[model samples]
Target: MSDIIDIASKEVGYKASSGNKTKYSAWYGMNGAAWCHMFASWCANQADVSTSVVPKTASTTTGMQWFRDKGRFKTKGSYTPKRNDFVYFKSDGASHVGIVEYVSGSTLHTIEGNTSDAVKKRTYPLSYHTITGYGVVSDYITSSGDNSKGKNAKNNKGKEELNYLKKILDKNTDKKKKSKRKVKYKISKIRPGINLSVKVIVAHGTAKYKYQVQEGMKFSDERKGAPGKLTFTTFADNKRKITNGDAVAVIVNKRKFFYGFIFSFSPKTDGTLEVTAYDQLRYFKNKDTYISVNKTSTALLKKIAKDFKLKCGKLANTKYPVSRIDDNATLFDIVQNSLDETLIARGKIYTLYDDYGNLRLREPWKVNVLISGQTAESYDYKESIEDQVYNQIKLAYDNSKKGTQEVFVVKNSKSINQWGVLQYYDKVDSKKDIKLKLKSLLDIYCKSGKTLKFNNCFGDARVRAGCLVPVTIKIYDQKVSGYLLVDKVTHTFNNSQHLMDLELSGGDFDSSY
Candidate 1:
């Protein structure tokens, strides 16, 4: 007999080739519909079992109904879920379903599909309130952890006994020897205009550097994409000296060139030098300029790119009508503030970054790669539902000459019912700006119900900041499977392993039932 859990486990890292479209697309007869139930159906098909073994359906509720019709459905609290059994949940409605992988004490390990955009395994306690019921497969018995069959069983036992004795006698301690080599790094290349190259040497054994870039800003700050330090050991015979504002580029995680510039450099105690640098955006942040004008958001973005000698990347198409703005802002300030106004007025999200010294503004939408339970060696997940969420938003703009303040309101009553009237308020100078701004605000805040902090996982090399990715986690006793935005990503490669530390956040998705 084929074990369904065993088969499902083999497919742990399987994912959709494109957005929400998987190999099971044809089986479910839908291109991008939620396929958690369909995944279970496909697993059943793999076992070559009749529907009597596990009723096949694409709807989570429908699957539960089918089990009820068979007189096989039992509520979770009343009946303990066993390995290979189907389980369902109810949230805002019937939210999600999955197959129980195994039960360990009060915890249930499950193999689920359509979680965080791929098939994944999750853990939940028996007391998780969202569980609806468990559908038992009448004819399928759980595996006993024994693979031996027929006359081979006795032979396998004899071999195990012999192996145990041999292991005891041959034990010479399997501890691996630790290497004592000094860790160091080398620069493979520098950008074309940087104009200097020299042998790299560090004064401190473990030099520290950090960089951060955020979604809403033209130039990164100390908090995001801020530059750390680059120290070099100097010699009196050496003719070249690394100076402030010189461009430095190095490979991170063997992924791509992390380009930055020297902010400051100084001689250290023993005659060596320590150079501190910031991201390329630091140039814009430190440089000062002023301009007073009436311009569309796109025009302003293009201007900032031109002034900073950056190639303009993806520009949002919305020609936001902004007028009569003060010019007392820095180059980076204008870029960030204007971008914010545009997003609020246009109802879209954009990211600004120094792409290899080229300034680019792009919407974060592309699904570069998949991160699944099997692919991740280890991971840390932290989610937040902060003041960032809103079920209702009120936008007020004053038409000064007209002697009236026009107020536009947007509300998701269904969300309010669940989250209550978490209201937000904003004021503007233009009445024509209220509806569009409120539309964008509601779209951003209402949808982004939760944010995530993911760390220490091996991710696809293509994964980067501003990309869309799906994630699966159990929160508050429910399986929260949904897509998220990779706001910030740090890649580190050591000991032949690539580890990705991610700051992921996303907008509203219906919780799995």
Candidate 2:
């Protein structure tokens, strides 16, 4: 809350030693630069609001842009000032920034750095024309305590955020120790990136006229938070009813696969048309700042869709409340981060996709589709102790009173011997249960990661990313069977053939359909 004001106030009487050198400028990597924004950034950091409520920057312009991007910026004279909010001033552009200390009706009291070679208390009229704008800092609620109008919240919000951070520190922990029901299917071998396109390109180079407009159409629907992209080749004889910005649908055998607007179409050297279309999810690529208070992920999505004038459909109720500031984030990243919070806190995965032209948010998709190797294909199955697999959990807490660092550790001797002491380390607040938390983290991170991919499976129109499909395959004398979330899927279609390649995640299988 008002902690920023208090911290900045303490520095008000401190003068730069010389050569524009100050503690703030030194920490910001520009020891000799003007330090007003750096001073504000340092104060916000000490207040634990930097980048969460205020931007961390050395340039006042960048900080102003951050507020504007988050829609938290108010032009000068247009807004009533509040504690911890930023006051930016400009001659030509934003040249200086300060922390608001108090507002008395139309008069403003502030603290600024790099002014007259020292930090000092400042006063100005609220309608000062030189004042460019104000960056709103909404998290601090100092109005509740001592009427100081500065400081942190004295409410349950702190506890909730603390718990949220704890959950993030222990993101790998699963309440249930059991894996879901397994599904066995044959698989296909795969390589990295554009498996289908690689083959078509190789074939075209050697076989000539392979995979041209005669191949019909290909559909590629990406997972949650990603725009659905459709790429197809067709002859002009098929009628050029589709144009840029026109709604385009891809259907084969009476099964509608992709519904989106054609963004671009070009003629290939082979006298065939190459077209690309993207679903409504494409719009979420827009970046903006969003502030939510006690709103569920689904509810927030609805609000965002409405605010952007996008269509929405079939949004599942995600009851976990998200109350935080996502400043200057892409809409896709905003939605994904919100869903990820639920995934970490409540162990639930949700999907946001475009159904036809309508934006849809759904719970983890589970279905009865079976993956099989009857199409004369195999798969690449890998389980390795590399990457995020840890056998030991070590947490440290600084003890200022004792002048020493306290260490807590939980380790599996067998895993340590086998995996060679892979450790997950972080600093925890003194209030945390070191032993219990470490044990939970050890259980979560001490396992090998299993990755499954198929490159030559027969295309099924029903298969798409973000959906759980039962997959069964054997690896190293172990029959791995479970519902796998399709991380990405690429489908290709020709006159006589349709094939898909899938990269799936083999953990936390959702049995709910």
Candidate 3:
């Protein structure tokens, strides 16, 4: 393992050095470069154990594809990444690469080189979202299949042999112990938002050793759900055997524990026999919980607001004298009662005028009913006053005809209370003059609309209709002024007379009109 580590480290250093000289100059010049990719390459190189130089590349996507195409990458997503395999990143392009140090859960914690900084080891979450793919580069051998070539090879091979010798020495030293045993185990970090399976190994001289898994807790008291006895058997060699799919007890220790789960194995490694246990667990963090709440709240609010707005046409501004309010009162009961009483109320209409005192011709008023008492004390009506006034103006323009056209329920006011003023003029005879005049009027109205301040009521003018002469309407103090520009050659006025007639004949406009 030591020899492998050294070789891997050297290979990573080489890659980092090369990358720094070329594409990673910025990183190398910094305090320290990132090591995510370099470490990965080094581990892969060392694991190969062969004399051939492992193929290295700059492209992350291409490198992963290369391995996959060769049938070297693992099929199952859970498989731990071994040394000497390609590490990939889902970046802007196939640009990042690294080697695997170890695989835990769905992520690969690796020591990679060639990052934003110089070569260094970093752990990254492993998933399709981050990793485009990965591939194996080499096994426990040199690429050339030659173990006896250069000085570096000889030195590395000698070190490897020595490490093997050390392992044998350790095994022999343990053999002298008559009560020890060996156990196989796998360790992994618990990941957020996922259930993890853990395998633990225990070994040697156990007098019915008890065990307990707790999240950041001490292994002291069984009464507190601490170290409890595990069920298992002693083998012929006096070794206790445990495998996957075993039930385990998890306990709690200290107050305010942040760690997910913790457990202890007793009778440390014995040369002869071992005990093992496996468990699956999960963790939930704060961010996930918050996101769920936010999404749900936003959706609900949008739905309610949309329905209310559709019924009200536009929200009225309290700053406008044209008072309008919406009531949250249940409409079902009201509609039923109105129908039974045969009570039909007529809608009020008013013409709208622009700041220039011209009657708006194109844009028509839209009628909306206020159910009563739905207004909130804090609601700002000024924000939507323009829309409400425009709707009322549109209603009045549609009612204009040759005779006196009356719209019902016109709210009594201090100015122009009896009826609205509808003025007509032939302006299309001079197209250029009309256009210039219209532009000048619009500029002034827009400026006034921005400058005027009204606490409860305000008004402005806007050009909402006509192709030739154009009509400009001003809405002020709940009264509308409509200006119609007639085309002298066509002998036609730009207005909604036809619409008003239809409404009158069909009783579409309130019968009170």
**lDDT by residue for model 1 (181-236), tens:** 33222312212213221222222223332222111111122212323223333332
Candidate 1: residue 34 Cα off by (Å): 60
lDDT string, candidate 2, 1-513, tens digits:
335776776787999987989999886679999899999888866654424356667998888987786567888755555567789997565489988876665678899998898999888988776898888874332222211343444433234344544664455433233444333444333321333332221111123222234564566666665798988776543333445776665554565566677688887677777878788888888866676777889989998999898898889898999765454447986787678667756766777888777887776577555665654277877777766678988877667688788988888999788768887766553534456667656765677766777886777666777787777666668765677788788887765577788877745332221
Q: Compose the digit string of candidate 3's lDDT tens values, residues 174-214.
A: 53462233322231221222332222223222322233222
Scored against the true structure, residue 388 in model 1 reaches a CA lDDT of 60
Q: Which sequence of candidate numbers ranks them by TM-score, best first?
A: 2, 1, 3
Query: How displaced is residue 94 in candidate 2, in Å?
Result: 23
Clashes of each: 13, 13, 67
Question: Which of 2 and 3 is the better model by lDDT?
Answer: 2
Candidate 1 stretches with Cα past 4 Å from truth are: 1-240, 252-256, 265-275, 287-294, 308-318, 324-326, 372-449, 459-462, 473-476, 480-482, 493-497, 509-513
| Candidate ranking (lDDT, best to worst) | 2, 1, 3
